[model samples]
Target: MRGPRTQTERDDTTVEIVYAAVTGVLLAGAAFALVMSPVLFLGDVPITTLANLWRAAKITAVVVFAARICWTLRRFGRR
Candidate 1:
């Protein structure tokens, strides 16, 4: 049974949440771009293939984003 958080602790948590969100978005974007980069270099790909790649990129981005946020929060909480 932990006591209520102090003001500083609450502030720290808020900062951590924002930090996690920012970093998560950046990482997710990078992952998405990396996954979709092949589309940029391959000019003759079929539309279906492009669609599949886009889907994969979106999935990768979502997974990366969630993973990053969870990782950041877990790491911060241990402090």
Candidate 2:
């Protein structure tokens, strides 16, 4: 068996995990959109009140998450 990981190794692993997670999320979202686009239009689902609210919430979450990630990257780059 090998010894425990060093600080640098742990940091690298953490960075890799975060990058993979973000990439996976983006790719999954894209794939989902591509696959669901046709089905969404096929249905006559009206853009009613609750539907708009849910969509707004989803958009807000995505925007906030993106902003936070960008801010963190900028902060790190300044160091």
Q: Give all TM-scores, in the order shown.
A: 0.94, 0.48
Q: Rate the local accuracy (lDDT) of all candidates.
A: 0.97, 0.60
Q: Which residue segments of model 1 deviate by more than 4 Å?
A: none
Off by over 4 Å in 2: 39-79
lDDT of 1: 0.97
lDDT of 2 by residue, 7-78 (tens): 997896678558655854575466546544654666764567446645655665566556556665565556
The numbered model that scores best in TM-score is 1
Q: What is the lDDT of candidate 2?
A: 0.60
lDDT of 1 by residue, 15-71 (tens): 999999999999999999999999889978999999999999999999999999999
